[model samples]
Target: MSYSKQKNKIRLNLVIALIVISLFSISAGAKTLTDLADRKLSLPDKIERIVAIGPGALRMVVYLEAENMVVGVEEFEKRNQQRPYIIAHPELTKLPVIGPQFGGDAELIAAQNPDLIISSYLSQAEMNNLQAKTSIPVISINDGSPGSMTEAELKMALKFLAEILNKNDRAEELINIFDQHKNELKSRTSNLDLGMNVYIGGIGNKGAQGITSTEANYPPFEYLGLNNIIEDDKKSNFTISKERLLLENPELIFIDQGGIELVEQDLKREEFKYLKAYQENEIYQLLPYNHYTTNFATMLANSYFIAETLYPEAFKMLEAKEKANQIYKQFVGQPVYSEMAEIFGGFKKMKLN
Candidate 1:
């Protein structure tokens, strides 16, 4: 070969070596994360922007004070929703709707150019599909089930997710607030047996699910000394027969605002009218906690309200409204208690008569 041709061939080999090194370095420096689902994934070291899907997924982002990181939301979060997190972060309602859960559009998610995707809860199959379709790393943080977590599963989820987001300080502050209030509520009502079998009727699971909708082993009641009659009969969420309800005849029944209308409708029924709580008009209003997943702050506030209702003497110093405001302020950065209360009654006894 000519001398000049040999020199050019050597230069080409050096260029190839540099390209290979650069690719290897890029691959080597990638960060690895094990999400709550226990799925191992290699992600960019820096997660700048994200897309959140599934129930309460976007709300959890707000808790991290990381709304700035969210580039898109699901269709339902676009509205001026009642979830405290949604109410606090007005910017979320204006973001692009990446479509619904179960069938998120990868093209739409790609359009947002998110570096990560956060889901509140997703079946393993759903998680695999989302990650595969978008070619984006997806993490599921659960704080929804009682079996999954103590008090609020979302609370554990927040701390877990915050570690991943490098927001541990903020997560600690949030957890402290939850723990402090929960402990306070527990301390006062721990010993007092209100001697009352209570039923939280008119519970709304997804939306206004009517009067029959209720939670078994409700976290709020568990914190207080109250015994939920449903505790012995069921595990999670299930509607009880009105005939069975009449047989149990709980002394107190608190209605969730989400199911207020349905509760009112149920009150019109003669069968429901015969119940002890309905007869005495013990139905009171509580903010909806299950909407958009667990409203941990609201759950605490409602506990105080219930404690006060059952033992007015013990909680005379406490004001459920004030407590709700403090919790909302801490978690949401805005005390949206009044706004929510005005829309839906707060700790007020219903005058069904």
Candidate 2:
């Protein structure tokens, strides 16, 4: 072979080798994340822009103080202003709408050009399908149901998302605050044997319902060791019949402000006046904690208010509204208790004539 030809062949081989190394480097840069669905995903090392889909997904992102990274949101989030996270970060609503609700529109999500997509309560197949459709790395985290999510499950989700967003310190801070509040609540009322039967009505399931709508095992009652009139093994929201409510006849009644108006309308009937709670004027109003999904911070605030109401001596030092604002600030980066109170009536007693 001619000397010039041999040199050209060597140059070509070097160029090919360099291309292979570059390809390997690019592959090595990606990190593998094992999502809650138990699916393995190769995500970009630096995820700058993201989109959160499904119920409680965006809320979790906001909890981790990573809302700035979100480039788009579900259409419902823009329309609904009840959620504390959304209320705290109104700018999120201004972002591009990805889709209507629940799972987002794949084409719209793709158009946002996000580096990653975070989802909640989605099955493995669904996450895989979304990733395939959008050609974006998708990670699923389980946030269980609102008001029913275990603390461990919530912490796991927060830590996972925090790790992904490089907000580990924030995760720790949140977890600690949650623990402190839970412990304080338990300690306050653990020994109290509140024999009086209590009931919370006007609980919103899908939309607002009347006084018949309630939770079988209300979390605030469980936290405060108060006796909830309704008892079931399954901790879920369901409507009870008026006849059954009359039979149970709780001594103390608490109405969820979400359905307070409906509850008040129901009270106009003389039959409701026969109940012990009505006769003694024991009915009180509580802020709605189940807006959108679980307003976890609001739930905690509700627990404080419930405790203060049931055993005033136990919580004499505590100011319910002030405590609520502090909790709202810790969870959502803003004190949203006043805004929430204004939307749904603030904590107070119901006037039953």
Candidate 3:
């Protein structure tokens, strides 16, 4: 071939190469996707910088053992600054606090350099605003409901956490353990005569209001195969009066943190001590601090304590300490065996009279 002809062929090849490169760049740009929550999101192969916007989401990160990757946390971090685990990580405590969905410093969030943001139950508008403010991806998960969120939701969230953190194995393992334990609990309680008189009592001195039988409190009662005895409160996070509570006389009373304090003070009055729950000793306190904080291990611990107490004969094989450690390793990725041992050290074993 002549030299001029060879040069022309080379020019044609170069033009084609440039066109292909341009197309590839456009395709990559097209992939900038948004999720159901509408937070600007891109599913990059890995996540290194994470921002958790809700207390529940933050707790999930702690459980998933991805605390190191967290770049920022919301206002709750400030409230929990003095909390032992959080205090140990001074950097997290020092990070700037952001407001909730209603209002937050969007510019401040962009400056933090996050690769992804996790939220729980955020409205579409709030999500869109965050996406607009940052180039990072945002994913949202639903908190478990009294009976609404099934195992599927847990696995779905786990898969999302795993994929985002690049720890698929750990997520699968954690999910499997929960499923296994739940099934075991069901089998054990299948035959028990779990009374339907369930009551949620707060520790306030003035006598806390009761949840109407319709409301769902937590997973323990449901997981243990016990029937919900309390009537549902029409509104969420409601308060009840003493007159209504006396009428229900629930067989089982589960107290949130500070609940027992109220009980202790109120029951001291001669008239209050005479109530059936007080007299029958059906009341039990939900362990403090950990209950509201969003840690899966804590939830599991709560579940075990409630189930084991209510059906001691069936859960004879359960070693609460060992189970707690399994959850810690599966999610927290840290062996909290000794630390948790202290936390659960004083649990009073339930005695069925």
Candidate 4:
């Protein structure tokens, strides 16, 4: 062969090899959706900074064990803010104003210079607009239904997070742990005769309506083997009137933070002071764990607390504080059990008349 022709052939092979390498890089780093309606979600080369815009996303971050990666959150995203898992972390509370949970300050989110944005459900227009304007990718996961969140959805979300954080083994371990606790709780309380007259009061300040006394929001109460007394009583979601609460006269009432405030306000009124929940003290306040009701971790915590409160003898096999510590350390990855206990302490031993 001519020397010039041979040299040209060698150069052509080098160009082809370079092209193949480029294609491989693109494929290996491609973004993907983990579930339904999920967009082209993929992890950055390394997710050193992230902005979690919803409570569900916060739960995902906690499960991924990426608490330190979170750079921002929605206005109402509660958790380690006051005394968080990481000391000196920026509190979303004092951060610049976002319009609301769904509508945060886009400019501020950009300013945070996050590698990825994790969100739950956002309106289509909002999501699309943000994607177009921002260089960072926004990945969303479903929050499941209000009737009850499914284990399937939780698993799916966790898997996506695991892929992003490169913690597949830890994610699987968390799921296994979650399933173990769930099965144990279900089995232990399966035959407890958890009769009717269980009520969950008031929505949160951010407008989370509590569980329907009926089948509408059945997951949490149903999980615990309790019947929500107000499920069918009201057609719409709102705070139950004193008359309704008095009439239902639930055996147990779970008062949310907002509901607790409302009831406290009403107690000043002579008329509402004598209601069954009030007089009997059957109400249990649900402290805000991550700004919303009932995630997997919160549900487990709530279940243990409620089980001890309802069937003390059965749960007497284990100490409640120990149970709390186990959940905090194993699941939440934060073993500040004493601090969490203090925050949740008020709800533990309150008498419900």
Candidate 5:
């Protein structure tokens, strides 16, 4: 071979080696993350398409302003129009359905061609099975209990999701907003003992129930340091018998609008009309915060309304609708208060006839 030809051949081999190295680097571009389920997953460095499965999974994505990257949604999410998040982003309903509620159909999820699958409230084994079936990275997240606005678990979940979606700034901003609301609520009602007996009824458990459905340690009541009639060691939701409710006989009764119809029907009974709240017309309605899971923003807004209602002089300047609109806008990028109010009668005193 000529000397110049030999030199050209060596240069060509060197260029070929560099090309191979570049390809290898591209194939290995992934980051390991520990999800809320404590599963270690290697995900692509830049994830452009994702599908959220289970309750509150898609809401986290929407919270981070990464909804645009969602490729598909659960059938339940598409059908449930009552949630504030869905009301704000109706386009999500237009996305292809991955499957039914809770966990999605693996085949349908894989068909979406998503780079990542976000699973909430799924066990590790379920997540592993999903990932294995779809050949996609699955990250499980927990959003704490439904209707809790200030739980640490929720904050951590948001941070973890924000990290994966490159939305750290948004996560911090949201966290700050939540903290501000918490502080404001605490400050507003920290002092002054009204010694008022309160009860929140018509809470949704598996689904909507009548006026007997109630939550122990209800978040809004706890936030404002109000005295809840139902006391339990563990925060929970359950139904109380009409006799048990009469025994407690709380001074003020707040109904969750989700089950307002059922509650209204219950009030028609002669037995319920004997309650102190019924006779004094101290019943009111609060926007429902639990749909698929907790709508943190709505829950927070409820606290303000409750405070304003119980201690009007303290919150005299706080306009309930305006404050609710601000909170909804911050969380979902839309002023959804009007829509929510339209669907579930806005904050108002209930007239038991």
Candidate 6:
């Protein structure tokens, strides 16, 4: 071959190489995102399809206004239950179950060919393991554990999701709603001379617990500046015996919807007859906070309801369900108050004779 011919061929090959590099650059514009576990992930710029695992992962996605992008859901959410969001977004139940609860099926997840995975309530190890097993970038969210409700943690998760989903405006709006209402609650109750010893029962941790189950630092009680009758432990859910109930004789009582049946059963017992709250038919019902993991909207709604129950004069104009729907609209982009009201008879006074 002549030198001129060889040089021409070399120039053509160089041009081809340059085009390949440019094409590669166009495809490598993927960015890195940090999950709630603080793990760094390299992800594609456009995330159109998603699968969420762990506890309440889908719920968090729904709050982000990205539930339509979800390609799969956990089996638990697929069940025909009355969780507010579940009822609002019935189409989600039709999707394939990624796995039962937190135990994800990697094969199923990969089959969906999701661009991203959102896993809630998972440790760093479990998150990384799932990410590796499925070869999909996973974002972990912390929305508190079983019966523990932490606003700061939930805010962090919301902000993190907003960043990933590019929904900063919506995130800010939701955050503002949370802060504004929480401040309202604090301002209303901060300096009050609280004397009414309030007792909350039927607090569900794992599932529908008995009436004896309760929490030490119940969020709504803490917000309302009222004294929770049981201050013995700092645990989330612990059963205080009926004997203790008789000894304390709390001024007011509230039951979680999850354990309403158990509460009614306990009310039938002669042992509970002497309790002042029950005897006066002063038992009120509140939404279940732990069902399908912490429903942040319900938690805030219940807080408002508790505040009203504690100080009727202040919240006389504000109906609890109305306030709850406002919170729900801000958080989930819809007025879900009616569904919640239908679900377990939300935040109503129990009038059993």
Model 6 misplaced stretches (Cα beyond 4 Å): 1-28, 143-147
> What lDDT would each prediction earn against the true structure?
0.75, 0.83, 0.55, 0.58, 0.83, 0.77
Residues 3-68 of candidate 6: C-alpha lDDT, one tens digit per residue: 795687467546533432332222367866555566667777888999888767777787878888
Alpha-carbon error at 152 in model 4, in Å? Answer: 3.9
Q: Which stretches of candidate 5 lie over 4 Å from their true place?
A: 1-28, 143-150
Give me the candidate number with maximum TM-score.
5
RMSD of 5: 14.3
Clashing pairs in 4: 32-41, 80-84, 213-230, 213-231, 214-231, 280-353, 281-352, 281-353, 282-352
The ten-residue window of minimal lDDT in model 1 covers: 17-26
Model 5 scores worst on lDDT over the 10 consecutive residues at: 18-27
- Alpha-carbon TM-score of each model against the true structure: 0.86, 0.87, 0.70, 0.73, 0.89, 0.86
How close to the true structure is residue 93 of candidate 4, measured as C-alpha lDDT?
A: 50
- Estimate, for each residue in 71-127, the C-alpha lDDT of model 5 and write its tens digit: 999999877788888899999999999999888999999999999999887777888
How much is the lDDT of residue 207 in candidate 5? 78
| lDDT of each residue in 161-279, candidate 3, tens digit only | 65557666766567667766665666677678875577555422222322221234546666676655544534323456656666666666666433444455655666555557667
Q: Could you tell me the TM-score of candidate 2?
A: 0.87
Residue 38 shift from truth in candidate 6, angstroms: 3.8
Candidate 4 whole-model C-alpha lDDT, 0 to 1:
0.58
Instruction: Give RMSD (Å) of candidate 4 vs. truth.
Output: 13.5
